[model samples]
Target: MKKLSIVTLLLIVSASLFAQGVPEDVAASAASRPAAIVASTSWTAAFADLGGLDDVPFIAPANLIHPPEYEIIVGDVLKINNADYFIYAGYERMMQSMGSSIKKDEASMIKINTNNSIENVREQASLIAAVMGTQAESSKRVAQYVQVVEDGARKVREQGLDQLKVYCHSMQVFLAKDLGLSVAGTFGPGPVTAAQIAEVAKGGYDLIIDNIHNPIAKPFLEVSPTTKVVVWRNFPDRGGRDSLAEMVGENIEVLLQ
Candidate 1:
């Protein structure tokens, strides 16, 4: 009778375990599932990468002169619709047109200022990391970003390029200043004005740091042909978190040249 009672107890224990509904294979699969992430442009994707995301697909082409102006397409809509998070800058035309349609509760849509300046990049990365629950990963990458900018600044000071007077574009002023260059005056996201042109002619600028996406250096150059113009880009040609740092380094190299 004791043996029979032991067998009965074993059966009851097994039944209890079955009733709990925990399966090893199913639990493992759920834990391992990947998050779906999408971004409006490569710039935003890079920020997401800095935030500790392994994979992020961007909608706008990186080659665009002005990525924020890109129009959203059917595929882009679908991608954002199905993604777990959609990251973007609020300035994008896509966001202006379709932002209202997005169901906020259904999917996370984040808007962050996209700039490669040391402070902006660090702050944005930290903010993004918090949202994604990847603060540990972001802290490491943010350190790398800071190092890259500081190294570039050190290189500039070493080469004596910081002493040269620069006429910088409004959009690229942050980077120009960060590299420790002497910016005498700033120009436009629009056409160089007659007043601005007059100022440039007399400013005796050594270099004109123009925006690669929307160059407005011709007027400044027309007035002062001797002033060398080095075009710098805010957007990266390739997609990756490191691309932002690479872009900044490349800009410094061009300035040095």
Candidate 2:
């Protein structure tokens, strides 16, 4: 009678376990998908500062404001940092329109704020690194950049560059902030007028950070011959340090001379 009871109990337990769910293999097969992240152009500078290409797995054209039109995978992730894609085609609306998975709130996604201070830049690198699961490698890479910026600031202060005030147009502000330089004024990256030069110089700025797109250094310098002028390249070169950083470092060297 005891032997019969043991056999019946074994059969009951087997049925209970099987009733809970399908086999592991079946579940995994149904959910087969690889996660991908699409970073926008505004955050590309943050990614560039992070310096771990293989880890992040980004697509081409680092500064593209909108990604190329493509099929939206239900499970794929998009990194939108205050860009216009959401406005042009709403995130939820676009997902629904695509007839894929209905997207939910990105509680899992990381965020970087709108502050453009040098400290903010470093923080953005760390945040992006942590999210991508490469914090250690990314931190090491970012440390080098941090050192470059710190050294630039130190050199500037040592050379008494605080006495030199500059007017940087558009994107050159990032370079200016990193070097601990003061911006007396600013303007567009477009063409400059003699009147605008007089207006900016009227504030008694000591230097002019010329726009990379416009070759108005000569024109601006002509207007204010007493004030020094330097070109601020907005992009990295083929084989060199940051054009922005290089400009700061070169000016420091020139100051020492």
Candidate 3:
């Protein structure tokens, strides 16, 4: 019985050693196996510009200033705001909501009307950008353009209608380019007659300036609320000088009572 027990213990020890040796042998065999040869991929080679093995065509940056199929006046809209201006037919409804006294003169009336027109232009512009899948980029670019217009308007607030005309003309040129409109003439009074305004309204440019500055210099800045038309008025200097610097070295002096 003792010899049989001793024999059984020896068999168990041999079995344990064999188990351990089998794993070590397997590990050694795995270690001796050849390593995988991985070829490094060049990412730049995939682009068309890079003479890489990849056959992918490189995409060039788009020109926002002159986008294809961008019409300045399509279907009669001035194409200022993101959308078309509401026709004068809808003007009454918009005016009613303003709760402000309507001006009697053509200038005041045009100001109010033009303000509304600009709002519609911005709406249309936004709609176009959204549809083109470039809304995020266009919005950023247009906002900068709007800020520039506001800055220029502020500078010309106290100036006379003549100065304002020049300012507005400059602003119009800047905005037209930013909005991808045709690089047309500056915002001077053109021969846009009342008859033309009515005709344009049928398509979209409903608001008319009516040659207030000049029948020829018909300078008007089209805007939407997003277009940021800031009008600075009520400057301290009666002659429309808002700054002390403007007051100095001036041939014209206003004696405040």
Best by TM-score: 1
Model 1 lDDT tens row, 1-257? 96455445544543444356648996787568876789888888888878877658899999988988886654566677656688888888876655444434533877788888888988888888888899999888878878888898999999988999888999999988888999988999999889999988886788899998999889887788888899998888888768777887898889878
Provide the global lDDT of candidate 3 against the true structure. Answer: 0.27
lDDT of each: 0.81, 0.50, 0.27
Highest-scoring model, lDDT? 1
Candidate 1 segments exceeding 4 Å error: 1-32
TM-score of 1: 0.85
Q: Clashing residue pairs, candidate 2?
A: none
Model 3 lDDT tens row, 202-237:
433312222111333222232211211222111112
Show model 3 residue runs off by greater than 4 Å: 1-118, 158-257
Question: Model 2 residue 78 lDDT?
Answer: 26
TM-score of 2: 0.53
The alpha-carbon root-mean-square deviation between model 2 and the true structure, to one decimal in Å, is 16.0
Give the runs in model 2 whose Cα sits over 4 Å from its true position. Answer: 1-51, 55-117, 193-195, 200-203, 213-218, 239-257
Q: What is the C-alpha RMSD of each candidate to the true structure, in Å?
A: 15.0, 16.0, 31.0
